[model samples]
Target: MLDSETKATETPEDHADELRLWLRLLTCTTLIEGEVRGRLRERFDVTLPRFDLMAQLDKAPDGMTLSDVSKRMMVSNGNVTGLVERLVESGHLDRRTSETDRRVQVIRLTKLGRAEFRRMASEHETWIADLFADLTPKDVRELMRLLAKTKASAQKSAARRRP
Candidate 1:
């Protein structure tokens, strides 16, 4: 039988509320991402990176280039290339050589790919909502505002530290 055990960690009673909020945020992100990835794999046999790339493209008015995808994903060019290649091979995406710039290849979702992405995105939204179902709509709105504020501050701090 598996034992449901947990190790103890030092409590930050000196700053317990802030510590608890940070821990909760971390735990929620991990659990939500885990469940999101699991659903994608189960339903489409797709990895999260590929799904993320497709999702990003879906939001763009124009399709993305290989370099653009890499930059937006904050991943290495090689990594994006590998994932895009796999997606292309699976017939979920189409690659086109740009007429204005032959060197740039634009990647766009095929009709099938668009359909798949839309369906998955719908389900993903549902999953995230369900995960936070216990929270009221007002609570959710407040949480989003707070999280956005936190993210902005963090980014500002990072910018200041750049050498």
Candidate 2:
């Protein structure tokens, strides 16, 4: 059987609405991701994964492990390891051998990392909010509700495919 993407070439007249929704969603995601990535590079000279890891650490005062970052970021364990190593080398974070479990290494943001994360996090929120600033409160609420439902359905589909 052809994959959904391959079958999408049929351009079924009956599926026009779904096609339009997917195209719009794709365009929106690409635009937002590109803009945010450009802003991060221009403002902080930091990669998204490194910034994301720092953001995760910023939320937890006690810090977390490499596996924790991998789970939260939805990245491979090897990718997390490389990113964490680079951050540690840059003086933005540290990984200490766990005392309770000597086999585990816990990662945390340094003072410099926390300060940088605060600045970036503030700007990130402003940028995201600005994207919807033209919408009224009702519009924003409705969009959030619809998007949440769509997101949940997509997640369920992905989960079903996993095993």
lDDT of model 1 at position 89: 92
Per-model C-alpha RMSD: 9.5, 5.5
Cα displacement (angstroms), candidate 1, residue 59, comes to 2.1
Candidate 1's C-alpha runs over 4 A off are 1-20
Model 2: C-alpha RMSD to truth?
A: 5.5
Name the candidate that leads on TM-score.
Answer: 2
lDDT of 2 by residue, 1-163 (tens): 7778877886554868888999999999999888888889999888777888898999888999888889999999999889988999999998899999987889999999899899999998898888768999999899899999998998999999995
Candidate 1 clash pair list: none
* 61 Cα displacement, candidate 1 (Å): 4.9
Off by over 4 Å in 2: 1-14
